[model samples]
Target: MFKSIAHSLAALSDRFFHRANIRLKLFYAMLALIVALIAAINGAGHYIFNRDFLGYLNEQAQQRMEDMVPRLEQAYREHGNWDFIRGQPRVWFELMKPAIVEHNGVVPPSGPPLTPSDLTGATLRFSLLDAHRQLVIGYPNIGPDARLRPLLLDDTIVGWVAQTPFENVIGAIDLRFQQSQFLAQLIIAVVAVMLAAFLVVRISGVLTRPLTRVARATHRLAGGDYATRVEVESGDEVGRLAQDFNQLAMTLERNEQLRREFMADVSHELRTPLGILNGQLEALEDGVMQPDAQTLRSLKSEVEHLNKLVGDLYDLSLADAGALAYRQTDMDLLPLLRTSVQVYGERFSQRGLTLTAQLPAAMPVHADGARLQQLFNNLFENSLRYTDAGGGLHLQASLQEQHWHLVFDDSAPGVPPEAMARLFERFFRVESSRNRASGGAGLGLAICRRIVDAHQGSIAASASPTGGLRVTVVLPARFEEQP
Candidate 1:
């Protein structure tokens, strides 16, 4: 039961402390620290001032008492006893006063004689006594607590002077003055604390405003508002954070657009083959078209298209998931390149395009032969489908600087400069139309990119000198192979 109660109390405390917003927490923390610092400074200042000021008053009183000794001895010598000084408060006070003038100004000799009331401000009190230790003059309340000094005449002690330490004074005026000082200090400390708190609140607001914007932007992003952005107002870490956040938002926005396009393209690509097969089967069932070799071949071609699309999608998924199978081998890429060109050279010719090959006898590379064949097939197919009739197709290969460079250049109609960068993006097509009449699911270049990347090579597309798309493939060469 005790453990449960303790846990409940701890949870409640956590809720209380943690429920406050960051701005409030920061403001309170800064305000508390500033107030504590100011309080400590003021407290130390008061302590030192009180100690030093009291010490100075005590020193002055001690000096006055010592000076009174000579004056009392002169009076005693003239009177030959304490009779001249006894029962005279004014005379005792005058005798206690220092002979030298204070630095502020000198007092006139005809000025009013000092009294116990006058010395109260200085925190000093006095009493004069005779040779027999009898009280003569000064404060009636003087006791052994006061310091004593001897008054002498010709080396014989005439009487004793009893003086109070500055600390012993408890007069109303002194108490009132101390209370006023304390009140002033208290007021000053309160004002300082209030001012510090106000400044802390303002500073906390300034600091937390950017964080608030980021939080709001995050909320919007969570709600699928990928277009949300924040303004960067400084060259500090917070500003950098805002910049990074903006970049993240832009990437998310671009991804969202791509995702929508991918879904649409997938649906359209699927529907085309499915619709053709459905229409053909329905026509055959309705006796509108006879089931002949040509009809069967048409259905088979549509099925193959669907199968190819599905296979390409599967390959992409595997590559994205880092699960694509690769059978690496050390082999001559020159023979493989020659075989791919020979296989596609007739297709280029069938389309009335000139296919030229610039070959090297041997180019060695460590790669998957089947994937490399597929990569070359896709590039040739792209040129076959997109290049206009009578255009030229060139296949060039060379080994340079421990790498194999393959260039595929075809004549116009070519892809736009702006479309070149996104040519390798999945489901991206320069045509903007989802029709497959030109024979591609737009996954060919994307698959080619994955193949080259898996081999630790780089691929890029640019404008050819023939005003066509120039595709460059660079792969690390196995230079140790003599063949």
Candidate 2:
């Protein structure tokens, strides 16, 4: 039960307090506080006024009842009681006058013996009650069962007047006026609180709505949606946030612009030399000069290095632009692995690196054939480049759950843990100085990443048990063929 109550309270608080913008939260908080205060004040005012009014009315009723007690006692003492009431004598006319004025203009009948018709509209009526419930009275209007104030005599209980009316004319008038005033005040309080709550809600929404919009824009910006911005309609916190969001978006866009410009600058710096070297090499090969074998070999090697650099740059450019193409097909991967190994057989033999392929006779995969070939080529070249002389390089293919897994393990210096994470970042080199020595322009893994992504697969690098870098590629065994 306690947990249930706690959950209910938590849900209620969440609904009332959790908001998307600070300004909206503040506005709601202030409005709720104001409403609570107003309601408390209104309730207190109603309670006090109603209590005081009822107390005053009750006190006045008791006071008049007490004052009439002595007059009724004197009348009973002087007159002959029940028989005298029918006679209705005028001997006590002066005494009744004061009581008449006190009882709101009600007066007893006077001047000669009066009939019941003559007593009509009088300020007071004299009455008597017998043990048999019979009215022995001056008029029929005051009956034996009529409600009346008790008449006491010298601290002794006596027979009561059966009925009586208020003697003061102004008492009823005053009461009617007080009732009207109280009702008006009560209505005003109710209306005022209701109007105030409504106006507060409307004005708060007007002020905080823009802030909500700006908050959403900021969230989008933080999520790398640089294109998002808000329009400022007022000179306020909301407007300031809008202005800040626009400024932030501009700054991010400009930084991105500068980064693209820097990449272009680097590309131009590397490409210019390759273009010049290629032209010079063509000119030399046209028999412009008869170069020695050693000189020729040196120039050819330089040309090859230049070609590699240009190729790496081109691959990086395509990957950055998301423009790498693929030609996906479903085929057994074993034959493809054999074919790639055969092309690099002479280089592997020369380097004294043992290249071995361990693959299933038939393992089906749906992927781009040419792109997959390029991907494997990069892995093989990377392994051969780093593997020490007489070291072993192994290629394996197998099935793992829904994916076809390809792995390359070589005996070479494994990648450092710190550099492993950034291995696939464009132009990110593990050893900046030594990368060029190994004919690595640092774009191989990046290209492999794009190819794997195009095939909706994953490629990762880890330490192999052979104490070398292990490259693992996993692709879905079958894909819906793209038309």
Candidate 3:
């Protein structure tokens, strides 16, 4: 039963704390600490009053007893008998007051004699008696523990003055002072806790409001609302977090736009070839065209174009999924470069373009020969398809800084400066300069970029010196193989 109770308490507190947000948590923590401190101060009040304050009061009582001796002796000498002060209440108070021209440590002295009212109920316990030990007109209850001092006249004992000291003086005062002090502490603690709670609420709210907004925006973003944004009002970490969240949302929105465009372009590209093939087959079905070599070739060409587009799309998916296999070996790049240039030379010439080459004798590198060949093929195709008639492509390879530097500069029909940065982006083409009529779906350069990245190299596109586009490829001589 005890174990179950403990477990239940633990679970209850855990639930409560978990459900509380940062502002409430901070406010509760700070308020608890301040209340505990105030309780501690109030609890120690008795010890302080007993060990220090009460001891000082007792010492003063002893001093007062001594001060009264001289005044009583002088009073007896003046009256010669106890008749003058035997029943006088006013005279009794005068004698009860201290004869010293001084004051309590706190209350300042006004004139001559000082009053005994501040003695903490000690004055009312004083009494006078004759030499025969008979009680006079003061406190009636004098017990055996009463302190007595003699009145001597010419060495004869005349009478006595008695004061019964309280047995538990400090403990008695403790009761009276404790109640008053507890009330004061309760009021002060309440005010202090209230102020602390107010400050904690304001501060914690300031710190967590931005974070709360970011969390809400993130939830909306996950729900496909990519356009959500947060207002930044401060330069603290919370503000920076909001800024980073805004940037992330912006990037996701742009990517979503690109994804829609990519689907539309793929559909258009597929429909063109498929529509041509469909029309040709329908014509053959209706006997509108004879089955000749040229007619078959035209239908075969449309099927081949559709097949190539599908193959390119499949290859891109494999590359993006990191499933594209690469077989790396140490090979001289000069032969590979020469072979690709020679193979594409006829095509460039057929298109009324010149293909020039500047090859080093032997450039050694660690690379995948087949992928590098594909990268070179794509670069050449981009120039051949897009450049107008009479323009040519210039290929240059060199060794610099332990890297294979391959640059291609083609003539005429330059890319726009704004489009250069996005040249390797998938499905991006300069419609103003390199029209859609001359280019495939724009996946060639993006695939080239992925190939370069796999080889742990870099590729960039800029303006060609020959008034066209320039492509620069840099491959490190040696690198670790990445999985």
Candidate 4:
């Protein structure tokens, strides 16, 4: 039965809270917590007051009974029996009065007088009994409920005085005092609850405000509003969350810009070669030029350039998506580097440039050899096409601690300092130094970077000490046997 009730309550709670907004849910949660605390404290206060207050009154009654013992003994000594206070309300009242002393500078009256403050019914609830334990007078109900004190006369037993504590608070003044205490507790609990609710509402608002803004901004960002951002209000977790959200939005915005630029660059790169091919074919068809070896060669060269551009674009896309096929083997990069240099050496010479190399004889690494060769060939081509006549290009390699470091330094016709940072961006060209009229379509270095990254390596470009562009590649040293 209890389990079913608990399950019902849980389902009801979920129904209310599952669809609620965060701020309202948090407010209700905090409010419930404080209300439970208030109920617990109020219950504890009531229980303690009911128990301890009665105990306190009982203690005061016992003290009064003890104090009246000696007085009763004195009365018994004077009257020779319990008959003096027996059935005499006046005598009993006088006997129960508190001992008198000087009040300020005045003396109390010389009589057994009743004070208005003794409202615990101690005077009337008392009983006197004989030495044989027979009740003389007082409250009729006297049995196990009595608190007894012995009366003594000259070290001998005289009689007994008994009292009953104010356990039920029957008198008007005592009942009012008890009721007032309960009322005061109720007022305090009500005020505390109201104040707690106010403070919790304000606090919940303060905490959830930034979260609300972030949620809205996230929705906007999902809706393609990449420029969405939130103001950071503090240096806390919530503030950091806002910072991260703004950063995500900024990244999306930047990526959107790059995507548009990529499409434009691709279109321009394709249109140039295609337009040239169309123009040449139109001239031949109109009989404006002879179909000789020179015309055929020109047509073939344009087709080759267009084919190379499309191939480079395809390879770059594959590399960017991490879908490039890598036929890795245990091969020394030195041999591959030398092979590319040998192949490109003639081309560099044809362009009136000298190529030199200072490579280590062997550098073991587990990598895609063909991709590395492609990387080497592209670097050589970039230098081959850009360097001025009679200038040279230098290739060097060495083993750094746990990695192979290769540097390519070529002679003049250097990349501009301003373009160094974006040297490896796809389709980027330096307008001042390296133009489209120069040889590369500007994707070689970008592909090289992707290949190096796939090998768990880093590539960077800087101003070479040789007054030209410097490309540095660092690849981790590994072996198929070691793995």
Clashing pairs in 3: none
Candidate 4, residues 415-462, lDDT tens digits: the string is 888899898999888886656386677899899899998899999999
TM-score of 3: 0.73
Model 4 deviation from native, Cα RMSD in Å: 5.8
Q: Write the per-residue lDDT of candidate 1 for residues 1-483, one digit (tens) a residue.
A: 999999999998577557878766776676678778867987887777669866666666666667677888888888788777666666766776655555458665665555343454542376777877678887657765687888777777779887776666667987898899779878877887788678768887888899999999999998999999999998898899999999999999999998899999999999989999999999999999999999999999999999999999999989989899999999888888888878888888899998899988888789999999989989998888888888978989887888889999998877877888989998888873222377688999999999999999999999999978899999999968477
Could you tell which candidate, 2 or 4, scores higher by TM-score? 4
Please write out the lDDT profile of model 2 over residues 12-79, one tens digit for every residue: 87877793345446656665776687678868866875577544543443443355457767776776
Runs with alpha carbons beyond 4 Å of true place in candidate 1: 1-17, 46-178, 200-214, 231-242, 325-331, 349-354, 400-402, 432-436, 478-483
Candidate 1 matches the true fold with a TM-score of 0.70
Per-residue lDDT of model 3, residues 405-483, tens digit only? 8999998899999999999987788876676475787788989998999999999999998999999999988544799
Of models 3 and 4, which has the larger TM-score?
4
Model 2 CA lDDT for position 165: 32
**Overall lDDT per candidate, in order of appearance:** 0.83, 0.69, 0.83, 0.83
TM-score attained by model 2 = 0.48
Error of 4 at 7 (Å): 6.7
For every model shown, what is its TM-score relative to the native structure?
A: 0.70, 0.48, 0.73, 0.74
Which candidate, 1 or 4, would have the higher TM-score against the true structure? 4
Ten residues in sequence with the least summed lDDT for candidate 1: 115-124
